[model samples]
Target: MAKLIMVVEDNDLNRKLFCDVLKAQGFEVKPIADGNEVLSAAREISPDLIIMDIQLPGISGVDLIEAAKKETSLKDIPVLAVTAFAAKGDEEKIREAGAAGYLSKPVSIIPFMNAVKELLPG
Candidate 1:
């Protein structure tokens, strides 16, 4: 079965781009626009991977990642955090929050897919 990836991004364009690319790569994708809905959706779907955007409404991706890591059922799922604000030490902060990987905004297809493949179990 194709791996299921949940994409949690607030930007419509970014979300669409991520979902389109993942779908084209033969992966199943669940696209979400609201930060508030991520946890519930994650728990319900138990996706193989989560593509998280650091800036989101209601809750930040860092907080969500930390929260997910604390959940026994969701801890093992890897999160690939995507952020437009690529400030210094941001990657480290996201990683410290329990993201398995990090990608800056305007992500290239090769690296984006590479990160996804690296995180997902084959």
Candidate 2:
């Protein structure tokens, strides 16, 4: 089966671009705009990987990742925190929040896909 990647992003354009790229590469994409619903959705989907936008409405992506890490059912799925914020210490904060790695936006297709492959290599 194709790998399932759950994407939590608020921006419509950015979400579309991210999901489109993944779909084009033959991966199933679950694009979510609300960070609040991420945990519940993640539990249902049990995705192979999760990519999230750090800046979001309602609950922040980092907090949601922390919550995901706490949940036994979702804890093992690799989460990649994707943020446009390139400020100092952003990557460290992302990792500290329980993400396996980080991806900065606007993400290039090759590197983005490569990150996913590294996390869920076939």
Candidate 3:
């Protein structure tokens, strides 16, 4: 079966771009536009990987990923922290939040896909 990926991003264009890229590369993509909605969907879907945007409405992606890591069911799913706010020390903070990797925006397609491939290798 094709691997499933869950994307948590608020921006319309970013979400579409991520989905389009992953789908075109044959990965099944589930796009979540709200940080608040991610947990419930993640519990139901149990996606292989989660690409999360740090700045979000209601909850920060770092906090969400940290929460997910605390959960028994959700902890194993690797979260790749994707953010436009790649400020100093943010990468360390993101990693401390339990992200398996990091991708800065605007994401270069090749590196982004390469990271995904390495994370969820078939």
**Candidate-wise lDDT, in order:** 0.96, 0.90, 0.93
Count of clashes, each model: 0, 0, 0
lDDT of 3 by residue, 1-122 (tens): 88999999999999999999999998899999978899999999999999999999878999999999999999989999999999999999999999999989989999999989888845
Model 3 spans > 4 angstroms off: none
Deviating ranges (above 4 Å) for candidate 2: none
Query: What is the Cα-based lDDT of residue 24 in candidate 3?
Result: 96
Give each model a TM-score.
Answer: 0.98, 0.96, 0.97
Clashing residue pairs in candidate 1, if any?
none
Best by TM-score: 1
Consecutive 10-residue window with the lowest summed lDDT within model 3:
113-122
Question: Higher-lDDT candidate among 1 and 2?
Answer: 1
Q: Relative to the unseen true structure, what is the C-alpha lDDT of residue 6 in candidate 2, on a scale of 0 to 100?
A: 94
RMSD of 3: 0.9
Model 2, residue 21: displacement in angstroms?
0.7
